[model samples]
Target: MFKKLFLLILLLGLFNHTSHAQKRIGIYSLSTISSKSGHLFGLDSDYNGLFRAIPAYCVDYFSNNADFITIDRKNFQLIENEREIQKSESFMDGYVVGQGKSEGVDLICQSVFDVDTYSLIIKILDVKAEKVLCSSDKKMDKNLFGIKDLKQQVTGMLLEISSKCFENEIPVVRVLETKGKKARKVLIAAGSNLRLRSGYKIEIYELVNEKIGNKTISRKNTISSGEILKVEDENFSVLEIYEGNEKLLELLNNNTPLFCKPTTN
Candidate 1:
């Protein structure tokens, strides 16, 4: 009888040890993100239920290895039901706006907006990286607009609101802030800060020959499209761009301040 008891206790101890050995690598929260784009940003008391849901999920995710907090599916359903109403009212035409110009040009633009519906839109933006990791609209609603620095903005937000999800109260792990001496020709997105030169910094923007109006605002000299790197130094740079067959260079002339544009929503 004593032998059986000893074995049982040993098994129980092993089970406990196995459970304790499990560690969580991350905490994810999918809350109903109320933003200025959604027009529900600051004008309503609609956050009470959403806030309650966040903490509960954060706690659960913190305690469990593979658990995550998510925006309630029902809440998004309501948004979907209202999308057409917003469209018919012409209320969904929002844009998250900003602007940009070739290195050394003085032309610039203001910020824009985007209409956001209550859809299950996943926007994986990293404010630290200042880039958009994900932007997927699960609905055919007319209320969503794309962002400029979707990444950096997202990171800033997660740090601002979801600091409870990580061990380091730091909201983002900045790759640009940490990088040194291994890049070329930087790319600045519409609406990003670009007073850099020479060496390294995180650059964000979609590298494409996109035309804004009749202005051929792309790397006009034929720079191939690649991920834009961060500016490295303070010297006015004659940076080269290569997108497919177009290889062009823009002098970082003091002709323009860096800028990014918003969506038309």
Candidate 2:
């Protein structure tokens, strides 16, 4: 009787733990062909069946994990119906966030397939923070039969994506040179390799020292701002002073150790 009672108690404990530990996740339909074509194509019955099949695979992958609770098609469809009733715009990010909130999900994951490199890109967003927690790309190559194996290919990829959760944001790039020496334009340390876009506003910060416990800590002082005028190559970008103020130009002339972060509005 004591052994049976102990077993019952253990079962109850496990049930309670699993009930409270789940992190609700919403997986959107996979989008294919990023670099080859700027246009985004969604899942359909006639084409790219593999992309449509990915969401279910994701659900199965996380089913055993006590920390995850993926929103299935039924719940996701309900959210879509409600969105239509509310006449809300269905922009991908906005839609995902709305669905996540409606379903009380903690995170939303988006899958994308790039045709050029045959790579899969996964992006996970923290629903409450309204920010991307992580993004990773994995190449899906064909097997010996010269055919892609969705399950085998994406299993390892999913493992990689899962491991990157809660990672730090992309590191800040630095300013390498000022264009034309004393000119308002500058050269920076990011380019196509980092997937940087042109016309992006950036914040320039200078390294400053602060004393703490007999140790000097480095801090950033916002010195100026600029916009990426051109993407030069894999290693460099061209920036021009966005503010065009003499003070900012003078700061550029001062030539202090500087770093830049992409400006967010």
Candidate 3:
């Protein structure tokens, strides 16, 4: 009997280690300026009240140029574009290996005033590999003049100029700590073993109360997403779940504590 118990504990520990290794997550935001809008420069009037924002290409070209615009020769001008600068440096390096242009994240952006829209693009090249990492479409928001006593067109132009200055938004990660009280719904899915419907409800309890404290909250799921709604309460040693409204009940899964209804709702 003693030997059997020892072996069981060892096997359980190994299974847990493997389970954590398979989780997948990779989401990121690329760009957020009006870099893609075609409408540049706006107008100011009394009756209908209006002004067009800067043209989209101008925004795109300007953003690529690092927000700098200088007069060119007698006829045209030069846009110190962000992507253009990157491209020129690559050609000069003689190390670019891509078939043609490099690739990077692609994204889009929009502003508040325009009913019409713009499309712009940016591609960043890695110095060592000389390959594009990502790209995006960006939009701008002209919200200041709409609300406060301020200049909307000037605000928009300033925004465009600012957009031209930055390469990309810095990436940040936020870690959330959770408890059962705040938990809206629970999903109990274990491959072919467990199944649940959208509106089904259940109670959640803490398996390891010491670590979780007492923050376990609950909600009623007025909606469901079929298979994903089922949670797998591995900690409970059984299959159970709780329901929540659609707006509140997003993808609920994992070892969510399931309580006997009378004890909870």
lDDT of 3 by residue, 1-265 (tens): 9999999999999877775443211111122123234322222212113322223323333333322321111111111123223233234223222211232212212222323342233333333344444433333233555422122223223233332334221111110222443333332322111122223233332223332465763333222221124333421222222333332223223423322211111
Best by lDDT: 2
Judged by whole-model lDDT over C-alpha atoms, candidate 2 comes out at 0.62
RMSD after Cα superposition, model 1: 19.2
Best by TM-score: 2
lDDT of 2 by residue, 45-116 (tens): 232565666766676666645578866652244232332232222245566676678778888877767766
lDDT of 2 at 6: 100
Scored by CA lDDT, what does every candidate get? 0.29, 0.62, 0.28
Candidate 1's residue-wise lDDT over 1-265, tens digit each? Answer: 9999999999999888776564322222233333443332221234334333333333332333222222222222223334333232113211100111112111111111222443333333332333333343432223256333333333333332322223212111111211123223433421122222222212222224668888865431322232324333332222222232111122223222222211111
The alpha-carbon deviation from the true structure for residue 236 of candidate 1, after best TM-score superposition, in angstroms, is 32
Descending-lDDT candidate ranking: 2, 1, 3
> Model 3 — TM-score against the truth?
0.20
